[model samples]
Target: MLNFLKKNIALAWAKRHVSQTENFKNNAEKLQEELLLSLVKTAEKTLFGRSHQFEDIKTIKEFQDKVKINDYEDLKPYIEKVKRGQRSILWPETPEYFAKTSGTTSGSKYIPISKEGMPFQVKGAQSALFHYIAKKNNADFVNGKMIFLQGSPELEEVFGIKTGRLSGIVAHHIPNYLQKNRLPSWETNLIEDWETKVDKIVEETEHENMTLISGIPPWLVMYFEKLTEKHSKKIKQLFPNLQLIVTGGVNYEPYKDKMEFLLGGKVDIVQTFPASEGFFAFQDDYTKDGLLLLTNHGIFYEFIPLEQYGKPDTERLTLKDVELNKDYALILTTNSGLWAYSIGDVVRFTDKNPHRILVSGRTKHFTSAFGEHVIAFEVEEALKSTVLKYPAKITEFHLAPRVNAESELPYHEWFIEFEEEPANLNLFKEELDFQLRNRNSYYDDLISGNILQQLKISKLRKNAFNEYAKSQGKLGGQNKIPRLANDRKLADLLEIYKL
Candidate 1:
């Protein structure tokens, strides 16, 4: 009776959120325009706002003209001030928590999550599940145990501000009502070692009625693998009621086949576009390929064409200005006091009416060693196509250029961990090469001119990616292995470059 009531309550709320979703969909441009002004007005008294003359900015154009698009480095000084207990430095009030995240070159980064902005983050996540429930007209999963593989929940205080991994911080926000149905236990979740944590989680959840699982794809994959290996049975045999999957941080296409195989059946996947900075999008329809961008959230967004990015006169585009199928660098100004911040993600619009999008790749994460400029989307799509014919399940894969004279011609090298190897290895390589060339014209040109050889595959041993990640202290909880690298740093570290 309690489960029935909970499910009904969820459905009712989902119904109401539909209208709210519709309003934002139809009036995205208007909503965004209002939000930009509102954010400007709200933060005008803050140090950053005052410095940028936000009070005088009445229009989006005026705001853009007054404030330049900034990366983390540009805002580091202000972020430092906030870290030292300065109030009204970036936002008007002190942050409720600082989401600490790993950076490639900057090392540890502490991103502020304001008290005012935190609820919207929680809302975006709720709406994702709510939207799924409303569309499917089924909330069976609501009553069952749900697990979110994440960073250790134990937090450390830094100068009066609680600081921890973004996932760890979010873990603390799970509602009291749902606490009974969430796992693993608090004591187990506090284990800092991901390997031990995952093993403990496997023991705890192996026999539970788990209906929903949430985490980044790679970590979730590890959990599934461990569970199946321990019981010597597929996931469906263990958790027959499992219905939905929630994931973010990386593209899912490359892992779809492997994930589904591990599940032992097809399941609805909810892909969310979330970052330490903010929640941007979530999959609203199971049938659709793209995530619906949230316009009504406390964020005002801007986009710069991928080709025009980093230029002196590059134009910043709003929701109304974006075109379908064009790759753009996503920029955000949020209620949490991020002003015209470039989060380094590249996205492509799949639909224009309601602004549905796909995360194309990262602006800084691509391989252009031979001027091919191969992006993650292209590589993932190519691999997807090739795998259809080759019939291989990939655990993980990475691409880097091989340019040494000792090895022969310059070429792209793929280090792949496969659960199921292809029947014909040479034919598999040929198919992959063909698929990539079909997607990237520059790569095709290079191959045709004999400037580069066809991409080579170095089949990696099982748990190769996990070992590499563990070595870097990023074995779990939202850490994604970069799909494309311009240099051989990753390849050299993993020792996969030696042919």
Candidate 2:
């Protein structure tokens, strides 16, 4: 009964606060204080356990004063220690689950999130739906089967027990309060699990009354392309109730047009920021970006300047110190027992107090091919702008930088697949190249023969991403082709069919 009352009180507080954006903004100081108080409790449990690491209030103040910034790489060993049931200088208790990342850039990163931490992630996702419904003035559509296209559900056993990947693990923990009888099953793969079920997992949603679809942008885009090719006319004949699509994990620019084509019209779309570690944020309204902060119900936050990310001299700042439009690397001390932990994402504040943010990119996910210094968001924007000039027929594209042996500079290469041929293909590529070079100074210098050579375009095979994903042992779920490759090794493989 006490737990229920506590949950209700928190929910009521959230409802009251979120309903008034102005209130949230104005009360930023109070919110920061409250967040710090809660964080101190979490920190005390972890850092100053029964033996009392802090010992006195003065030491606690000193600890806060001297807090250091950290990254996921820094937290891995601590997480492992906690997983083994050892109390660390941070977490007072052991973590319950280890969530697995997509492993898109490198090997998968496993994040330890506790049962207490899970509620925040789940509530944040659901609140986005509420926000969407409020925006649409259609609260009636809140209950339905939300098709989540995630990884295969194969659990690798550790210590003689069975456990699935992060997505699967989270799905298994979904509370009964939010579930519907008709909820969309995790259909990426059910058998053979993660390691081997790539081919066996099917992409058919023919019979399901899918009301909302959520997954990584790439797999969703590929799935929509296949739907248009195989069951274009018969879509209404299959899932007649399909309504909204929620996508994240990667950029959405390339697949926006193709997705609408398959849906037969512009279906309402919501983007989200859910890592294997947590469901961080969501595009509450049909906005171009997202509204975000830590769930008030769970995690606590600290910030460090973006420029200070890899530097050893970086000092951590509390929420009180943050400024709007400035980039900050996040330091999280969570209910799950992670302290001063950096999740590796770089973000900037979009609004103050009410606390909305936009994820810029990972600190490492950049293209400096010949000093171009192109970030992921820049590349996504360039492609989005280029696609706007073309007919709505173009579906998807991927960009990479290729180094030529004969030329002095590296070139920007694009692989595009369209629904129909453009009126003038050469004009399209030329304009795209011009715009990209003009928008980014680095690219312009390259084009001026000061640095890099030229830009190239490639026409991918129809459903090239699908075939590529299949070849990589991926099912039609959240995983998709990378939009930008930062280095020469990955870029060479992407330049095969130059247009």
Candidate 3:
């Protein structure tokens, strides 16, 4: 009865929010103006605001003019100051906590989570489920446990402020009533050893009525493999009532076939765009073409075309100016005191009616060493196409550009640790090269002109990536092997473990 009531209330709230989404599309300019005004007004008294003269910002144009765009480097000084017990530096009130994430260029980053911003993150996550329930029109899944495979909730204090992984901080905020229906109890979650925690999770949930499972795709795949190994049966046999799988933090297309085969049947898959910076978007419709942007979530957005991203005079477009199918880097100015912040992820709008998008790749994750730009989306699609044509299942893989004075031409090198190798290795390479060339015109041109050689493939020993990750102390919980590198750093590392 409690679950039913909660579902109904949540569904109603989600339906209302969905209705409001249309209003956001229709009056996007007005909504953006209001959001910008609210942010400026609220932070006008804070240190960052005073330094930037936020008091003079009464319009979007004024706000943009006064505040320069920023990446993590620009805010590192303020973040460090706040960590030293400083108050009102970036936020109106001191941050309640800090969420730490591994930075790509930098070592580690600490993101402040103000008290006011906490609810927005919580609400954004809840909105995902609510949207799912509203679309499915069934809430029976709420009765059973929802297993969230996540990192440790154990937190440390940095100058009296709690600091941990974003998911760990979120775990502490899980409502008391729902705690009974979530998996791997706080104790198990706190276990730092991923292997031990996975065992505890398997022991704790092997017999429970699990209806929903949510986590990053790779970790969930690991859990499912473990469960199948332990039970000697498909996951559907163990959890007959399992109905939904919610995944994010990485693309799911590459893992879809393996995940479904493990389950023995098709299941509802919902993708989300959640990050330590903010909960930005979620899969709302069943079509799965793109994610619906959370327009009213106290985040004002800007988009810079991928080609113009790092250029000095790049034009930033608001919601009203975005076009379909053009890749753009996402920028945000939020209620959490992140002003004109570039989050580094690239996205392309799929639908402009309600502003839906597909995350294409990271600004720093692409490879364009020889003028043949290859983004993550194209690489994933190419791999998926190749796998469908050949008898292969990729367990893990990484790509990097190889340019050497000894070689006649530059080439893209692939280091693959395969679960199932193809019958003809040469054919597999040819098919992969063909697929990538067809997907990327620039690559095709380079090959045609002999500027780039055929892609090189190297098979790595089994569990090579896992061993490398463990060595780096990033074995589990949101840390993923970088899929593409402009240089040979990853290739050199994987070469050491070649089969």
TM-score, predicted candidate 3 vs. hidden true structure: 0.95
Model 3 Cα lDDT, one tens digit per residue, 142-212: 78889999999999999999999999999988877568789978899999888788889999999999999
**Cα lDDT computed for each candidate against the true fold:** 0.89, 0.61, 0.86
Give me candidate 2's TM-score against the actual structure.
0.81
User: Which ten residues in a row are the worst by lDDT in model 2?
Assistant: 193-202
lDDT of 1 by residue, 1-499 (tens): 9889999998998878876789898899998999889888888899999999988999999998999999888888999999999999889998888888888877788888899878877788899988998999888998999998888878899889999988788888897867889999999889988889999999999999999999888888889999998999999889999999999888888888878888998678999998988989999877888999998888899999998899987999999999998889999998888889999999999987878999999998899999998898999999898888989888888899999847588999899888888999899999999999999899999999999998898988877888889888877765788988999889887674223
What would the TM-scores of all predictions be? 0.97, 0.81, 0.95
Candidate 3 worst ten-residue window by lDDT? 17-26
Which candidate number has the best lDDT? 1
Candidate 2's C-alpha lDDT? 0.61
Error of 1 at 272 (Å): 1.0
Question: Model 1 lDDT vs. the true structure?
Answer: 0.89
How high is the lDDT of residue 307 in model 3? 84
Candidate 2 vs 3: which has more lDDT: 3
Model 2: per-residue Cα lDDT over 116-211, one tens digit each: 777667776776765665566543233445566556466665432334566666676566644663243454446433323322222445445666
